[model samples]
Target: MFWIDDLWKFGISAFVGTLTVFVPLLDTRTEALDPIPVVVTIPILKDLAEQVGGPYVRVTSLLSGYENEHTYSPKPSDLIAVRKARLLFEIGLGLEVWISSLVRNAGSQALRVVTTSQGVELIQDDADTHEHPHTGKHTTDPEGNPHIWLDPANALIMLRHITDALIEVDPSHEAKFKANEAAYRERLRQLQKELSDRTQRLPDRRFIAHHSAWPYLAKRFDFHIVGTIHLQAGTEPSALHLQSLIEKIRKEHIRVIASEIQLSQRLPELLSRETTARVVVLTTMPGGVPGTETYLDMLRYNVLQLVGALETT
Candidate 1:
């Protein structure tokens, strides 16, 4: 006959053994609940992916907001991230010249590279006419400008691509992605309207861009990009071009020169000193500037800051 203590011991041992067997199973289930992994070429894409994917995605942006997208080189971690990701999002249009090689090297058979700029109408980089001092090569995209995300309308298009991609990879979360996308679109529209209303009040809307990144934004917001300081990436403008820009600003009374945080400020400042036009440093990427983390926030910040500068002049 078994004593009561023996039975108790037997029960405890059985419970322990069962737990030991099931713990890994439980851990696997928990791990399965984790979000899908994704990688994006830039911070703006990361924001869009997160907005649409919500809790369903774990996104890593290869280029932080502070880096120049044209000149970015993928780090080893970027390759690792690409290898692990189910999807990789980029603006395309030759924006990330280095991304293709990285993807090839990553050898991620499951990874889908989604070009978010697929359907949107592209703006030609007219700055190509100005010769770059170093390479003398045109930095402009032969197809179209890669800085399409600078405009809110283009952002909506990009967001749709992100939503579609997320749904494609994780169909289980389709409803969530669609719903989040709709909510984000509504908010984006509201911000666009608000900014439009504010911009309409401006008497003069001409500015000099640091680079060719602003054509889409300028077109969307009805602002005029009177001139560009650097026509090519990683190249300096000629003295003649600088003198021309100074003459243009002085002659046209171009009140604002919009400089990017990612680019050097010396030229803009020098131009400012040469003329009455004030330099308002803005960012092409989200989180490149404080109070500009979200896409909407960055849009508002850029528009409002430029409006403020234009108004003051």
Candidate 2:
């Protein structure tokens, strides 16, 4: 027969042994259930986060593909997203003026804001030529133009920023994040090469941009931008500017006018009517146009559309 105290001790030991075995299992289950939450200002960033994060993160984008980045106002849901996110990615060249206020309003101490355009070389808008009156102030970095992602090279830099942020937050998944980034970059390079082959053989690559958003794209693929319709966002060009563009198009025999879907088609159409140039509508954001749901698809569509127009003209 065992003493009462000895029996009690044995029972307690057994309970402790069982708990020791189950505690780690419980921790593992909990960790698996909780994924890192991320928020991005634009759709492109959201896509990038998804590509890098894979199954480890949940991402939300504030602006859909059709919205204008320069003039977008934040919604109530944006604040809620920010409050829950561990990381918030933005382009941050004064492109998202509303983001600062949104983050402040959320007041999440743990949320980290990552600027993906930190290392990108900026194109300075010709202040002398690109000026217009505005109904309200637009956010443009005095340092340079904010539309850096249009260039594939700049996209690589943005990817690095995103990968680094993911690694910092979730070190355990560093290997996966790095691998995803590498694979994505390889795909980007391949696409760029394919597009370059298409554009390189073109006889004429000159076109008028609908807005001051094509400089980076033009520089990357050797396209020449002869003129821009809207030098400033939300401001109509003066009659004098329009007349000059028409005259220049006729004089230079510029055959194509590249218009963005996000902007009003009124000016591009008017210019097309006044001049002989054909309008080739393109999208700056993914999913703005059909077959452009992803970043790669958007790039291919824009390049091929412009190339086809240029070749025909």
Candidate 3:
């Protein structure tokens, strides 16, 4: 098994290694690149890269909104992005399985891959280990909950990582990164106040999410995750699974089933009917849906949705 794994790894390495370059450039311009090419896994980093990179940096997001970050298929163009990127930012904690191979193929240790989920508290997926539908188990944040972005307080930690990486790669932009971090941190603080106030109004602070994506939110707002609609990131729920969740809902009187905007809503909506719980769409990724474009707005939108759903229930 070990040799087999090694051989498979070698095959992937060789393929990606040779094809790293010659793919699409994120944004094309004739001038010599000034800031740096930074490849990020999801939208939050893209948003941050925009703020911190400003005019100096050029950013490319590997996964689009329709593309699930967890189970991403790297086009040759993606390898090209990795090949050219001076720095790669990811939510890490095994959130991106393709990173290791892609980096290996790019053959640039100097690329400086930064995992934003670093140093934040991680919750083990102890509820169950099955994979969900629409993607693989690899698509799920395997190291732990990579949804640290959901917590505004935790995003501050990501800013530190971003600043350090930017300063390391482009020391000339140290002040710019610092300034960006300071400004973003201030906005985060205001968002914290807003989230606290909004969450405080939920008469029933307890609700169940489709998965175990709510611990940070629950911790922040004193809400409770009564049960999960799915056991894993893409695994389908069986009859037994549905029956078990129904029992928990009945016991807890779970008012809302917080289905993430990124995931398919069929199961959550169906579970909502089963439990008589309202289906609430929450954004895990920045811009995962229509209303959650900015970090603060995402939190506000989720809190408002949760508060409104639970309060009315």
Candidate 4:
């Protein structure tokens, strides 16, 4: 009887393991998948994924707007998201370095890992390769720019990639996907007009960023990044670096010290105090903060924040 019980226990364990591997790929079908557990690293992607997935799939963002997306370390819940997710969408371009490890650990080959920036042909910048603010090669895409989302023009392209993946996973909602993509693109188009109109008239387009995070936006709006507090994404600024920036501030007559909500505002705040510059919080994603819940609102909020800082202080 003891032998029988032991055999039963072993068989149950083996069977459970086998099912876990095969069921989600084969038999496990849910009523709706629009909200499939999607693990995105950025908030804008989080919003976009939810838009494309609609009511059928559930989505989750691994990195919140409050932290640096480029320098984030993976958490346990992130691994859990990978384990449960049927399809994984990432920014790619080596944006999320921890992705490979998470995928391997989850051991789910059935999981679809889609790079949202696949077709954009990224922009390249090697001049300041001394260090990069993000992961991988110091200089960004030789093919094109990784910050494709900044250009609303590219968001239309991204929609195709996102919609195609959603379709592949769940073809039943093909029409709904198309409709959703179109609606989202139209909204983005309006946002492009709103952002472009506002930035066109600014007298001085010079600003200081903690890191080189705004090149994509700068190129479109004709804004210049005089210098970065920290050139590399993860490295902290040294005292010498701070002194140099203060000097740059005086020489350039730059008034706004821009800080991202994701990184340490303490440093930016200190620099602002030293230089008599006003500190502005910029959002890199949609719904990154409480107020900037949509992509349009996110860009507007960032631009408005910058404009306000430049105008008032």
Candidate 5:
């Protein structure tokens, strides 16, 4: 009877051990079917990926809408995110100067870098914008301005890139991805038309920009950019340039000065004090402001705010 009890104990122990090992294997298989990990340089790409990929992606954005994209420094956690990601989406055109080195350091051979700005017609700045003065590099691409996502039309192109990439990675979800992309595209077109109609009715459509970031937006909405405060990012305008802007604002009656939430408010505030032009703090990224948490929300908020300022002034 003692020998029988010992044999029963051994059998029970063996059964529990087998269950523990096999349970983890089953979990691993389920995890393999989990959402694809994605890393994007900016929030706009993250939003686009999530919109297109839906529940099929786990996306991480390196620069949360508040950071200056040109001057962003990657953190240790960013490397881990990149290493785990199968796809890394970037605005490209030299906007994210820090990304290439980060990816290299991550040493992820399985990672694929997708440039969302590819194939879209770019806007060449009449004057180049310098990178963060500390880095001593040109942030603006030699080819053109990399802020293509500012324009909803260009965002459509970006959405397409994300859609194609997601489909490539998860072919089983191809139909879902395409359907999501189509729905988003339709929403974008509808919003573009609505905003365009609103802007068309504006009596005054001219504004002085904080930086050379609005050409596409201006062109798309039929608004005019009278002057830019910072030709180079992360640097102050020369006294002479500021004086010239002041004079131009006074002379041209540029009632609205567009400034970004990501940049310092001191310059735009100073200008507002020196002139009658009101400063409207707008966001280039999706989550830069409280109400602007999505691409469509951002586009609407910016145009409406600008239009409201223009109409009031």
Candidate 6:
């Protein structure tokens, strides 16, 4: 009877030892599979983060490209996302004016806010004149235009910042992050060259912009921005301004009017009706339109669509 009891005790001891040895290993594996939680202010940042972070990050974008970034009101879910995120990326230069309050409300102790626009060259806008007429909403940044992502070259700067932040948070995946960035960089350069070459053959590269979102893109692709329909977002150009633009468009033969999908098409359509210029609907953000889901796709779609319109009209 005593020998049988001793054998039972030994069996229990062996099982306990096996559990102690295997439990942590299983836990470690599960922990490794859990991705880093990231929050971004705009879809473009989300795309850049995902491109660099790859499987290492789970990103949530506050603005889904459909919303006007300047006028966006943060949702409850946005607060929750910020609270859960280790890294929060923004274009910074005052583009996301609501982000500070959102992050403050989140009360995340461990959250690090990364401004990708830190080292990039900024384009200044007429902040005084660009205020929304109705709501008095300030559209342009006093610091600079926060649309740096419109240029592929600036996008590369943003990508580098994203990679650095990702590496800082998840140092174990540094090689993967760098590699992904390099690959995407090459792709961006190739696309940039392709677009440049295409634009080179165009006789008329001038257009009337829907808003002040095209300066960076225009600089990159050599397209001339003849006039802007809405100097300030959510504010309509006056009849006098519209008349002036119509006259300019007809005189300059600015065949293309670059309007964004995020904006109301009424003004652009009006311009088209008044003049021979064709409105080529473009997107400033990824996922703003079908087939422009990624940064590269949006860049290609914008340039090619504008080019097609310019050439045909």
Query: Best candidate, TM-score-wise?
Result: 5
Question: How do all models score by TM-score?
Answer: 0.89, 0.88, 0.82, 0.84, 0.91, 0.87
Tens digits of per-residue lDDT, candidate 4, 70-113, equal 76788998899888887777777766777888889989867888
Instruction: Give a tens-digit lDDT track for model 6, residues 1-313.
Output: 9856866878977767978999999999987888999999999999999999988899999999998877889999999999999999999876787899999999999999999998888776655455632235564424667788999999999999999999998999999999999999999999999999999988788999888888899888889887888876666678999999999988887788888899899999999999988888999999999999999999999999988987886
Listed per candidate, the RMSD to the true structure in angstroms reads 4.0, 5.7, 13.1, 6.6, 3.4, 4.4
lDDT of 1 by residue, 151-190 (tens): 9999999999999998888899899999999999999999
Better of 3 and 4 by TM-score: 4
Candidate with better lDDT, 2 vs 3 = 2
Give the per-residue lDDT of model 2 (tens digit) for 215-306: 89889999999899987776778899999999999999999999999999999999999988999999989889988988899899999999
lDDT assessment of candidate 6: 0.88
Report the Cα lDDT for candidate 4: 0.75
State which candidate has the highest lDDT.
5
Candidate 1, pairs of clashing residues = none
Give the candidate order by descending TM-score: 5, 1, 2, 6, 4, 3
lDDT, each prediction: 0.89, 0.88, 0.75, 0.75, 0.90, 0.88
Give candidate 3 misplaced runs (Cα > 4 Å): 1-33, 127-143
The TM-score that candidate 4 achieves is 0.84
Q: Write the per-residue lDDT of candidate 5 for residues 255-294, one digit (tens) a residue.
A: 9999999999999999999999999999999999998999
Candidate 4, superposed: residue stretches over 4 Å from native: 1-35, 136-145
Summed over model 3, clashes come to 7
User: How well is each residue in 147-264 modelled by candidate 3, as lDDT tens digits?
Assistant: 6777777878887888788888878778988898898889888878877887776678877787666777778778888777666555666888788777787777877889886678
